[model samples]
Target: MFKRFQTKLLQKQVAGGYRLYTHPANASYVEKLVLSWDTRRLTQAALETLAIIAYKQPITKMSISSIRGVNSEGVVASLVLKRIVKEMGREKSPGSPILYGTSNLFLKKFGLKS
Candidate 1:
């Protein structure tokens, strides 16, 4: 099945020997998937984490927790899965924690220019 997809130009190889593809004639559907927020609701914790990441990005999880007064690892993971936030990179601190930031999709969903 995978070979058939490759032969039909439905998939292409990328770095690290991975395959990437998009559904043909589904740009609108893909856009909806990326931009639509009405289909799912975010928990309050997730929303708070997202707000912090958007304003204080590229911030570390520890910093976010410090501001929110709680650990936000799970909330951050949810935001990452929702494509609202992304892992920017690791910080230069003691543990080299991952930095988080809002994604381009987040900007699009919120109708922001930048």
Candidate 2:
């Protein structure tokens, strides 16, 4: 596919031993890129929420609370705010609580493949 070719091109362009040079503008870009890539740059709450969601996906906030033994609402909100997790629509069950999953941004940030 075109995507595979693009990946190969990018890999060729940024071969081994490549490095980033930091000037004022490049430094700013680097900072933003690093923040986007390093999920750890997120708050502790976000990290915890992300872990819970990753491990127990398709789970509700109440279930998360039962497992984590604490309210995870705020942490979930922060992850959504940071574009790390996204609403995957709603469950078809009684409450119709929102479902969520990590976004492509999360994979890109963490250098993970789908």
Q: For residues 1-114, write the lDDT of model 1, one tens digit per residue.
A: 977665444556678686756656666777678655561478888888888998999999889999999999888887886788988999987889999999998898788987
TM-score of candidate 1 versus the correct structure, residues matched by position: 0.64
- Which stretch of 10 consecutive residues in model 2 shows the poorest summed lDDT? 4-13
**Which segments of model 2 are wrong by more than 4 Å?**
1-39
Candidate 1 clashing pairs, residues 3+ apart or interchain: none
C-alpha lDDT of residue 59 in model 2: 65
lDDT of 2 at 46: 73
lDDT of 2 by residue, 65-85 (tens): 777788988888767766888
User: With candidate 2 superimposed using the best TM-score fit, by how many Å does residue 63's alpha carbon deviate from the native?
Assistant: 1.9
Per-model C-alpha lDDT, please? Answer: 0.81, 0.73
Lowest summed lDDT over 10 consecutive residues: which window, candidate 1?
4-13
